[model samples]
Target chain A: MIDQPARARDFGQSRPHAGENPPFLLTTSSPGRSQRRLAVCVLVVLVGALVVTAPFARIPLENTEALLPAYAAAVFVNEVITASLLLALFSVQRSRAVFALSIGYLFSGVMVIPWALTFPGVFESLGLPDAGLQSTAAIATLRRLGFPIFVLAYALLEDSGSSARVSHGSARSVILAGVAGVVAIACGSTWLIVTSDDALPGFMKDTRNVAAPWQYVPATAVCLYLVGLCVLWIRPRSVLNLWLMVVLCTLLIEIVILSYLSAGLRLSLGWWAGRLYGLLSASLVLLVLLSEKTTLYARLVRSVSAERRAREARLTAMEALSASIAHEVNQPLASMVTNADAGLRWLGRQSPNVDEARAALKRIVDDGHRAAKVIEGITTMFKKGAQERVSVNMNRLIEETLRRCRDEARLGRISVQAELDADLPPVMGSPVQLQQVISNLVANAIDAMTAVAGRKRVICIRSARRNSDAILVSVEDSGTGLDPKYRDRIFEPFFTTRSDGMGMGLMFCQSVIEAHGGRLWVTDNEPHGAIFHFTLPSADDPPSTAGATVR
Target chain B: MVMSDDSLIAVVDDDESAREAVAGLVRSLGFLAAEFGSAADFLASDQRSRTACLIADVRMPGVTGPELYSHLMASGTPIPTVLITAYAREAARDRALKSGIRCYLAKPLDPDELLACIRSAIGDGKGRIE
Candidate 1:
């Protein structure tokens, strides 16, 4: 957790757009090109497989007694994982549609346990109370019918742009209620099917032969699956909707193979194929959700890092601006303090020289006004500044920034050369911000050269017309050439080579250039150091009178 | 208090009000006060030899206070110097002190501190003010 006081301070000072909407959820996000293609391809493959095996579906195969238990175990595990993941997503998204879908999966997964326990051959040897012959088929039919109904509920509720968000405290209760409801329904269905076993229509004439009415059960399930698929297809499809449609299609194929095409033969090729289809249907949505979560995680990491760098760059610009303003105000304040002390000294004198005392007092009053003027200038410059954009001559701006660096250049024994185009058109920007951009670049150039001893430290600044609409300025320093390893990372905040460096200078410069509708980049200055280049779009109209007065 | 007649204290700063106020304080202490707007102006002035103590702002447009002090020492006319600045960069201050500047002070200068620095700068024995 972030510290409260620090977060409160940063609330207004930084992160102006922190309250923006979070990354898109799968339920709301439209399927992308690759995702849509993959979903369609999977549906085509399932349909092709079913058609190829349809004629041979009824041919009986050797019965493996373990297959039923194993199939049930796999379905149970797959459904539970899928349902829990969907519910977890619902907890975060608080979307009612996702909650409905998850509850459906939960009910289907829980029904498998009772269906497996009551199958005639499996439990006969255990000496337990024999389950009715109809119990297994009844539970299996109910589970299949239950899933498509939930999907229909999900589709009906999936309105675009309207999130049915429950309040925070109620979200937990809502989730609990959905879970309890699924459990209650599964238990109620199992109890009713087991108690009324003899009264229910026989699904099998014997252990190996199907009854006449069993065809109606699979047909009804197939109809429900089609309705779910149709409703989902009618809605504007999101990633979640697209995958859910795939799930419904697989269920339709499973039902047709199990009863309609199997020709009343139990443990046939068609029956095994139908069970495999059921497992496939259970795994499809879970796989897509897992992969989507991974992709979203990667995107989140990149965006967070980018945001942190931008914030640091802003902090650096603020530091430089505040430092300069403080220096300006302090000069006048210092003068006033000295003047007041002088006035007091004059009055304390033995002769009490009235004229000298009065003159000293007058200077104090003047210094006080000067200090107030400094504050007033700042108020106009920043608080109400409006970041007044104007057409600025790049040559003059570069000259001013370099002049500010004159002392540092002299101390470092670096020589500066300017080859500016005299006819370069003015570009529109805030003069102070543009000044900062150039100063930061020039300062970085000087720093890059400070360690050089054998070669002369030189910085060449050039400005030229890049095209009709743009002007380019390059600061090339003959210090150490840009490190090949760090070339890309140098512009990142807090990526400094020097111990004393804050590593904010270049990042700040890049941001300022970008904000002014320009681009900044760095390249190796041939045979020696790095060349930093920036281009600004030229203003179409002639420079305004107010613009000419900025510098 | 009165300083020796031969003592001249030169005050140099890019800021007009700061220069005048520092000069005014020196004058009130009974020493001859010379004010210059920039280090370049002070360097071109004819009062370099006559000046007993130099009070200059560390940061200036053309030439800075510490630069002027170093230039004077190199030119064999090392005036006792006290460096002052509104923006007191620690690195610049340390460098100035190590180079034998008489004193290094941040702005909003205390009257007593300035007097003490000036007294020691001009050799306490020859230009003492009491």
Candidate 2:
């Protein structure tokens, strides 16, 4: 038993917390150079692989004279350039594992280069008798060295952000499994290599002509099958995992063709598996490259979206500042205007108006006191507003919002109205935030009415019961109908249709409502303008979250 | 500002053009007007004790309309206020009407309708006739 959420853990602790997110928001303009260089390096690897596999299509291992030189040359070139790229990356940043891998890669890249360069003739220079040089030991050395090239490539990938942390497996377990699988595959490959060269296994056959390299076809097929099973066990969803399995299956089928070549003492052509094997390997490498590119593209897209959201919040704050200021300043200003008007009237009247003049003076004095009081109220509110969250009444919230805009509505000749939902329950929320939302809806309605030339300029605001679940308030304006296409996106920040409006209004409204555990939306009222409505969730729900504590 | 019947309303505002305009609009419909220059004099006057509908300007220099409304509201004067402000704030309006404002009007207040709202909030001026 794994004693863990075995299947769930397979997705790991979300994504691996690694340097996968670069240290800084890097805007490196030089990516063009690096990307092109990487692309060229990839092209070189594929070309070298092709050139190396080509000549080997002609001869069996026993006929080494025909193929070794070119194979060595191709391997050497591919390894060297790959090593250079890794080394360049290492020099740019000392990201631990990459540096270590580069050390090994650079060494291997150099050794393979000389080996591929001196190809076919290098086998002749082995200084052993020709037949002895074709011994299984000779072939086994090449197999061991050739296999590590792929292992090294996997190392490079791990260094590039594909940390195994995302897979929930212990590092020790993965390493052990990889090692065991590689050893098993290597042993099977060794059998296929030795048998295909037609060297008889003393225990399996008597008087057998093992000179036929193609005779081991069934054994080679079995070896390829093992490689497929191991890759599938390691990573089911990885493209590399799927491609490696498919390639091995293809190689297994080609092994059947080897049977005929071996039987004809066409030991001269029995090395056919080598050419087929090289092609399948190269194709898998290409698939891995493509999958990596796609993963990079997805991660880039995710970061871009996060950046956009942060930008939008700041924009919304800027757009709603005016309404916020009005809500604060409107109260006292209205009071002063009323007191002044009353006082001014008493100044000119007849009937000696003695009592009336005195009364007006008293109101004037009262207006001054009220104005000072409102200013004090606003000063306290702004200074402490940023300090903490407080519970606010939805009913008073509506009134204050309307009063804030009282002057504006008066100036526009449009009527402002309100009907408080008598039974509305209190909701805990940010007052400023809720104010911003209601103001946006009201302002938009006022703007819409500006274009109309009719006397039906009533803005009916009604607050009503919304069943037992919510408190609903709707602002019904008598402006023209809104465009249908603009419906869903009206709440998208900075995406406004108005030339003078900061597109942030609707979006900010939606955000504020959402923050308060409520919903805000707009609709066309029957026969006329827009009806914007919002609902704040009741504060009576029993806490389902772990952190809730009743006061 | 509103007064229970027999008590006259003095709606003093500065925009004489707007004040008399509003006065004519209100008086033609029926309401009293005792105008003055600033709050300084209104504090020094006699009507402070017995006056009725106080339709004052919110932006007056010495004392604002809301300042007068709050003072009266705080004193438990039993007078209903029909505050008219050009403010677009929810908090302030809510505070003004928490007890029960006849109506919180935004100016330029509709002269005829505001009087009607004031009359309705306190009971038609005739209610005091009983």
Candidate 3:
């Protein structure tokens, strides 16, 4: 449905004038931000490398744990440094929540500080008769440091822009899926976990002859579920961080399945499953964490494309703009010059009674400047843009756009009318840009009335400062009314009835009005032509103070 | 201060604005300023008497200042004429002299230049421009 209509040929229905596109590229400053991020990433990698590469590592293996002295000295350093580097990168874009969490992670790594102060006789109290304390400390390093680092990554994901882009499951959906999958895995794995023992053609089952059920069933089921999940959620740009989830669920699937079947088997499946699940889930989490860079790279490319298109459109509009202004303003400029020249020549004669000529000359000079100002205004109209929100006079902008539309009204033999509300307050946005929006609407109203034979050729423009943070400008014409269903399509570019003319006038008006942090739409006019309505920011929006953006 | 057959008027313009502003000026001047948005709007408008005067813009829509004078000869609007222009180049001035316009006026115009020509026009029989 969407594909067929958009491709149809129609006058005025062309690609959007560049304004609708993203703004163009930044000048030389984009690289500065990239370089800073790169430096930080490299610093993190180097710190992590130094800690892991240090020789001799120790880990405590259970309460019966002992670690070699040299090993304790090595792996403890590796874990702490890796944890610290991750903690630093997490602080760049900060929030109170992230700040508090990173502090907790930092202190946990700080907790590893006291490991350096171990006394010589600690091995006896640690209950390691033969094994060294280094062995016990070995597992301590990962449990203490690795878990906190994972939590930090979770915090980063929650606060980033990519939060929306990442795949998400509702709390209820997750719980439902969890319970259902667990039961299904249990049934599916039961047969796999236990090998059937048959004797004498199903005469009787013998428990004494059968092996203990604590065998391969649970571990094998979990491994299979792991492989299934990997295939399900592994598409790029689908679910972020799902690979880790696939790993975690794989462990549970194996354990539950094995527990059911192990009743008929004879091995410690739980212990084996637990060991493998921990290693694999941790590996998957780290691998996903590394994928964050590519996602950011993709977003940057999208941002660049949006910018380039907007700039090109603006450039095309500007080239023809200068000539239009000169044509519009030349007459007034000529009259001003004529009056001024007459006065100057009169003064040069140095006549005794020159007061009459002097006054005429002065009026001409003043008139010349006034004429110049209007020309200046018409030419500078081409320079309009910049999205600084600010307070503006709603009534003033409406009256001015109405005044400019007088020429159009005269040419079309349309009578223009106004019902302005004096009590209207200031609205926010660029006054000139806002004027363009109003003019475009008023122009459209006049155009719609061109074919109407004789009911009424009146175009009504009204403005008000009511409604929250909004000022309204409405243009109503008496012409062929649009069907109610087609109202929404009117704002879409290239949607117009005029055969030779571009239908962009209203669409451009809509975009301009919208960009001001406002709204635009069409509705039924009073028993006649369609009404083009829009809002501007109210007085509460505040006045703008920035210079124009140079494209 | 109404116009008479013995009185001659001149108009100088190339666009619609020129027609309007000049008509307003001519009305103020107590003579007729027959307007032409172009030489075409002018030639299309009626003219009478060789005794009338012409005030032609140096650059016209069609029918150059010299050409306007040449066309006037056959039509007999035969009033002495003045040439007025924004770009008062030497070529246009020489053309006006050769074509029999008594004076060529530069733009950013002086009402005095026009008034003086009108006074001279009132007296001359052949509409000779001073």
Give the number of the best model, judged by lDDT.
1
Once model 2 is optimally superposed onto the true structure by TM-score, how far is the C-alpha of residue A141 displaced, in angstroms?
5.5
For residues B12-63, could you state the per-residue lDDT of candidate 1 as single tens digits?
9888888888898888776789999988888888986678899998878878
Please compute DockQ, using alpha carbons, for every candidate against the native two-chain complex. Answer: 0.54, 0.04, 0.08
Residue lDDT tens for model 3, A288-363: 3344446555767887677666655654564466455554466556655554544455555546226735654555
Runs off by more than 4 Å, candidate 1: A1-23, A125-128, A160-168, A385-551, B1-7, B87-94, B124-130
> Candidate 1 at residue A244, lDDT?
93
Highest-DockQ candidate? 1
Clash count, predicted structure 1: 0
- TM-scores for chain A, candidates in order? 0.64, 0.35, 0.31
For model 3, what is the alpha-carbon lDDT of residue A460? 71
**Which of the two candidates, 1 or 2, achieves a greater lDDT against the reference?**
1
Against the native chain B, each candidate's TM-score is 0.88, 0.70, 0.73
The TM-score, computed over Cα atoms with residue i paired to residue i, of candidate 1 is 0.70
By DockQ thresholds, what CAPRI class is model 1? medium
Write down the TM-score for model 3: 0.34
